[model samples]
Target: MIHSLVFLNGFEREITVGNALVTSYFKCGCSSFGRQVFDEMLERNVVTWTAIISGLSQNELFEDSLRLFLKMRHGMVEPNFLTYLSSLMACSGLQALGEGRQIHGLVWKLGIQSDLCIESALMDMYSKCGSLEDAWRIFESAVELDEVSMTVILVGFAQNGFEEEAIQFFVKMVKAGTEVDPNMVSAVLGVFGVDTSLGLGKQIHSLVIKRSFGSNRFVGNGLINMYSKCGELQDSIKVFSKMPQRNSVSWNSMIAAFARHGDGFRALQLYEEMRQEGVEPTDVTFLSLLHACSHGGLVDKGMEFLKSMTEVFRISPRTEHYACVVDMLGRAGLLNEAKTFIEGLPMKPDVLICQALLGACSIHGNTEVGKYAAEQLFLLEPDNPVPHVLLANIYSSEGRWKERAWTIKRMKEIGVVKETGMSWIEIDKKVHSFVVEDKMHPQAVIIYGVLAGLFRLMKDEGYKPDKRFILYYLDQDVKHN
Candidate 1:
């Protein structure tokens, strides 16, 4: 109709009309049609350029989005904040950090760094690109922090394993009277994580109810995750039951939580329920199911699910799925079968799968397979100290002093020093950290005395140290010490 009208009115294509049509088509999910109109436009402006770039990005054609942005720049079209925003999103989707950095420099050159949308986009780009420090620096330097920017940085911290810091910032934001948006609330809830105190989870649950976000799908999902991760499976189920709407993520989370808690039967039941309700399972759903089988040692059920995923659901298994299968088999003492499984994998086995087998071998004391897995791991990820250290421990456990010494020598030669073990506990709002053989704490003497007393009590209660568990190369005096 537009083309007919143009023909009837003898109207030359106006840039504004062309831009509006392009945006409309793109927004309506017709990027190809939008491109057709765009190509026909004799006179294009920055709006036209931005429409195509942003549309491509929104449609997940990140490469095309970036290519168009570059072409716009080459055509001498000045980029607006939207153009930079779209380009940065493309970079983020592609994890093109170098290109993203170049765009950051352009933002400075364009003198639009103060624009809130641009600043928020920059923070998001940096966060998604795995530069939390840069994202936090932007957050700190911003004269005004809006809810969006605050949420972005909060999520960034939570995702990067800075849970304590993320929780701290959540407190600060609340104390500062920032309105707790649903995403912010979700981010704070995520900080509860796997070690969340039941008290903390209940507190957040109360907050969710009080804030009237109990019915929000995202908030409900977050609530379920928090409860599940904190080992309150009943509470998680309660939340799931009460949710007004549930998405794939909600179902997946519940399944994963059940699996993680070693309840494969219940997990399978939930999977069946989800299917009965016409909720199609995603790849993550199968992963969780496989994990349940692995943890519960349900090898037959796991094999059935793996087969169903490919044949019935038509979903191809990923490396994580394969790893789960290997773990399941290895944990069952099917060492030869697990090795054959890896060798027959459709694709090359990843380091994670090899590491899984290695860990299982160490647990089952299969030094032969452990050696093979450790060799594969060394080739796959030489920089990682875990494979080498685990292999050395396996050798030591088997009393292979020569192999253990060789492993140690190789580690030293490669400059791969394992970090000293450390553990920490938070008590009464304070964190106390301790390392192996550490004696630096103010109450170290008292702490060690208590530990020694507990050890004595255990011995008196018929506890005996397993001699076979001792490291083979330690002298008797050193072991006693």
Candidate 2:
């Protein structure tokens, strides 16, 4: 109708008609048409300038957006808060930290930092550019920080590994009588979950319950994750059950938690329950289920689930899914089948797939497959020590000492050394970690004395220490030491 009106009215109303067309094109995401209409406009106002700037930024033409900002200034149109906000966003998307700093200078010159929207946009820009320090400075300088500003700061801290700092700020926010929203709790709990601090996680759990935020799905999901990572599978299940509504994340969390605990049957049960509840499983959910099947040696079940993923769920299998299938087959001692499956994958095999085959070969004493896996793994990860060690072990087990020596020599020439494995256990909420023969702990002498006594007791009980458990480089004297 507007186009018809323009045609009926002819060139006398070209500017009016052109502006309408430009606005319509911009709204419909036809930026090229918008640009054409904009170019034909006889006179453009600040609104016209802003429309183009916003349209370019929205389309992610960040460089063009910045160029248009310069053009707006040259045309003597002063930028308002909206203009500055859009430009700052463009700078952030482009990761133009230097340009962002220049924009910050402009904000200061224009005295618009106190403008809430403009300041928030600046904070977002700095944070997104990986400059959290600048983000915090802007946040602190603000006379009145809103929920949006607080969320941004908390997110910045979380992303930067300042978990404790973020939690502290969250506590202060509550103390200041700020209303705690679901988003705030979710953000804080997310950091707690990643830290894997059970005590801290429990404290957050109690707070969520006290604040009556348990019903929030985001909060519930975070609680599930925290409990899972903290090794409290039962607690995770309890929290999951209490959720008023469950999404794919809640189901996946429970599934993965069971897998982590080596309760494959329980994990499978939960997967079935999740399906019965009509929650669609994502790729992550399937990955967790497949991992459980692998660990439990449920080869047929794993293959059935893999088939159902594409046929029943309509989710396309990614490389990760293929890797999981290969790992499952390999772990179950189906070496040839695993190799064939990997070869048939539409995607090229990765080092992890090769390493999985190598691990299986090591277990089955399949020298042929072990040698093949080792060569491929070595090419992919030349600096890693596992493939070399596995190959050398296979040679040593087969009485091929010369071959073992050559493998060790090659490892040394490449400067690859097997990393010593350490085990840790938490007692009284403090973690204690030790490697074999490590004597650095304050109670190392007492621990060694106790271990010697246990060894003697075990020997008297007709138990023998598996010599294979000892490092090859260690002799009798070193073992005693």
Candidate 3:
């Protein structure tokens, strides 16, 4: 009607009307019309460019968004903060860091990088592009730190595998009296990823309720993830039952919660209920289902799920799904079957798949398969010491000290350092971390005394430590010394 009225009124060429048309076309998912309106306009301004660029971005046409933004740059029109933000969003979605950096240079030249939104977007783009150092630089140099920027940087840390730092940053935010917004709440919950962080997660849940984000579906989903990750299945179930609305993630997270808690049958039940409720299952949903089957030792169920994932859902199996199947077979002591499955895969086994098989082989003392897995791992991850260590453990378990020594010797020759084991205890809302044999804590003496007592009890209960693996430790000690 507007198009007709504008034509009737002969206001089609007017700047305001043309801008509206471009924006409206893109907003309505008519990129062709939006482009037609844009191209036909005799004159275009920053708003015109921003409308088309940002509109394309909002529609997830990231490539077109960047292209249009580039076109705008080549023209006489100068992009403002809004245009830069849209381009940044496109870059982030595509992880087009090189293009994003060029845009950053332009924004810096315009002297608008100090703007909070611009800073946050830039940081987000950098973080998503795997440039956490750049993101950190932006965060540190920001003129002011608001909760939104803080949240972005926090998520950046988490996404970049800096979960420990993310948690510490949250602690700093809380101490600084920064209000934990819903987004911040979710990010913090994500970084509280293991059962040890259950205390932290509960505290955040209370905050979520107080802030009235309990009803917010996004926050509700985060709460489910937090509870499930922290091994609070009952809490996750309670949260799921109370959700006002459930998205695909909500259902998937709940299914994964059951999978993680070893209730594979219930995970299957949740999946059926998700289907009954008319929610489409995503790739993650199937991954969760497969994980449930693996842990529940339902081999037939797992294979059926894997088949159904491709045949029924048409979802291509990811490397993780294959890894799950391998882990399942390994757990069930079907070493030969797992080996055959891996061999039949069209793609080369990734480190995840190899690691799973190697771990299983170690448990069952399958030296032959273990050696093959270790060889694959050696080719795949030349630097990762986990395969070397696990393979050596397997050798030691099989009474092959010479082979175990050879494995340790190979590690030394390759300069592959074993990753240090870390442990932590949360007391009085403070997480205290320790390394292997760490004696730096104030209560080191008492801690060691308690550990000694526990060791005696464990030994009495036939829970003896395999001192056979001491070869690797001895080498490690000598290397470090």
The better-scoring model by TM-score among 2 and 3 is 3
lDDT of 2 by residue, 63-181 (tens): 98888988887777788878888899899788889989988899899888888887788887888888999999989889987878888788888887788799889889888889878
- How do the residues 1-481 of candidate 3 rate in per-residue lDDT, one tens digit apiece? 8898999999987999999999999989998888888889998999999999998898888999999899888899988889999999999999999999999999889889899999999999999999999999999988798888999999999999998799878878888888788888888777767634677778778888888998888889888988887767999999999999999999999999999999999999999999999999888998999899999999999999899889998989999999999999999999999999999998999999999999999888899999999999999989999999999889888788898899899999989999898877667766788887787999999988887777667757876456435433212333223
How are the candidates ranked when ordered by lDDT, highest leading? Answer: 3, 1, 2
The TM-score that candidate 2 achieves is 0.73
For this target, which candidate reaches the highest lDDT against the unseen true structure? 3
Write one digit per residue (lDDT tens) for candidate 1, span 380-427: 988888788888778767778788889888989999988786676656
Residue ranges of candidate 1 with Cα displaced over 4 Å: 1-21, 28-30, 40-43, 195-199, 422-433, 438-447, 460-481
Per-model TM-score, in order, reads: 0.88, 0.73, 0.87
Candidate 2, which segments miss by more than 4 Å at Cα? 1-185, 191-195, 393-401, 417-420, 458-481
Cα error, residue 118 of model 3, in Å, equals 1.5
Each model's number of backbone clashes? 0, 0, 0
- Indicate the residue-level lDDT of 50 in model 2: 76
RMSD for each model, in Å, please?
A: 3.4, 5.5, 4.2
- lDDT at residue 220 of model 1 (Cα atoms): 88
- Model 2 steric clash total: 0
Per-residue error for 367 in candidate 1, Å, reads 1.5
Query: In order, what lDDT does every prediction score?
Result: 0.85, 0.81, 0.89
